[model samples]
Target: MNWQQAQKDFEHFLLIERGLAKNSVQNYSLDISKLINHLSTNEIRVSPTKITGEILQHFIYEVAKILNARSQSRIISGLKSFFNYLIFEGYRDDNPMELIESPKTGRKLPDTLSLNEIDDLIAAVDLSTNEGERNRAIIETLYGCGLRVSEVIDLNISDLYFQEGFIKITGKGDKERFVPIGEITQNYITQYLENSRNRVSVKKLASDVVFLNRRGNKLTRAMIFTIVKNLALTANLNKNISPHTFRHSFATHLLENGADLRAIQQMLGHESITTTEIYMHVDKSHLREVIKDFHPRSNY
Candidate 1:
């Protein structure tokens, strides 16, 4: 197939078969188009089916020179997925990215806020206005539940179970899990809903959505980021903070306070225990205390 036809087919597969959104499909196509452009610039005349491992390796090498390690890693991963799709569709016999190794980058541990820092951020909110109270509630929920930003925005009134003390979170791939909500967070949400949200003229479609913008539409992920960034600045927090920082802090604090790792794993919706183990690295004092309290020779 010609490049144009192959591109069209790939786009259709991404949209119809994979069920990816328009922007996501566009990003995948853009990654492939970059490779196509590279081949053209190098005077190589190989179609998607005929692309060899050596050519792919050279393309990655050239890309590495131009992009940072993280960007290069992302591009490589995107290309691998694209080529894997081509192989799955029987358009290619072998995957050129089979031997492509991602760059060796150290795992940067996620940033976390101390309880004081979290308090500072929440206190920075001006609760004089309706939107201000809603924003405070949004921040409280994010830090309290350790929710992903998307999960926070998509939260519905029906998902909250304050009496049962659980909030059902729908995560990636539409997977659902129930997380325990604290009384403080519950009270904050209750205040927002009863006092702030109740006064708003919410849009019909967004009536059930827990957090709404000034326009009464569901909050966007970018808006959440902007909210957190502004709050951090207002509170004079020097550390680079994001919504995910609260999630890290939540996990870390729980682990430090003698909460079981397995229970944390379940609450955080981590499929693997190893993913939850990262929190174990954050607090060495907790480990020392555990050994002192439980070790057989401690009394000696």
Candidate 2:
């Protein structure tokens, strides 16, 4: 098969068989496209099935000259997955990336917003406008539920079980989890819906969507980033912040407040406790306290 056909089929496999989210599929596709670009620019003729480890090494070497260790490692990892998929589909017998090694990039900690900083950012919104109320709800839900930005955008009115004090979130890989919603978050969302959302002329089939742009369509991920960036500027905050920052803060605050690590994992919809363990490094005191309260030898 041709390169384009191979790319398309791989994406289909990732989406259907692997159950990866759209963004993940796109990232994988992008990695393949980079290889295609490398081959084209060098006037080298090769097919995906015919590409050897040597050629991939050459491409990665070229990539390393321009990309950081983190980026190079990511592309290498992506290409490894791509070739593995080909092997799984009977397109090849051996894995090309088996001998390849990824760079040792140490654990990158997530940035978090302090509670006062979060409040200031929320206060920066222009409340006179209808969009302000919607933005407030957006920020609150993000921080309160520890939701990924995508989760917040794809949220629907039907997903909210306000009475039950929980909201259903469709996370990465289309996995669904019900996260508890606090009274503050529920109240802000309800206020937005009653005062602001009721006025929107929502587009067809977007009626059930909880967040809408000024054009009455579901908000895009870029829009969420812009909202956060603009708010950061207005608040005069020196730190880089994003919707994910709220999620990190949510987890951090919960840990600092003596919430269980497993409970925080459940609230964040993380599939693995290891993923949630990163927060443990953010507060050494919490770790010490855990040992203090639970370790049998600590009683002495």
lDDT of each: 0.88, 0.92
Alpha-carbon shift of residue 238 in model 1 (angstroms): 0.4
Give per-residue lDDT, candidate 2, residue 63. 91
Highest lDDT model number: 2
Candidate 1 achieves a global lDDT of: 0.88
lDDT of 1 at 234: 93
The sequence of per-residue lDDT tens digits that candidate 2 reaches over residues 1-300 is 778998999999999999999999999999999999999999989888888888888898999899889988889989899888888988888878778888788899989888999999989999998799999999999999999999999999999999999999999999999999999999999999998998989999788999999888999999999999999998999998889999999999999988999999998988899999999888788778878999999989
* Every model's TM-score: 0.87, 0.95
Task: Count the clashes in each prediction.
Answer: 0, 0
lDDT of 1 by residue, 1-300 (tens): 766678888889888887665656787788888888999998999888888899999999999888888878877888888788888889987888989999977766767899999999999999887689888998999889988888899999999999999999987546689999999999999999998888878999998999998888999989999999999899999999888888899999999999999999888888799998988777689788888999999878
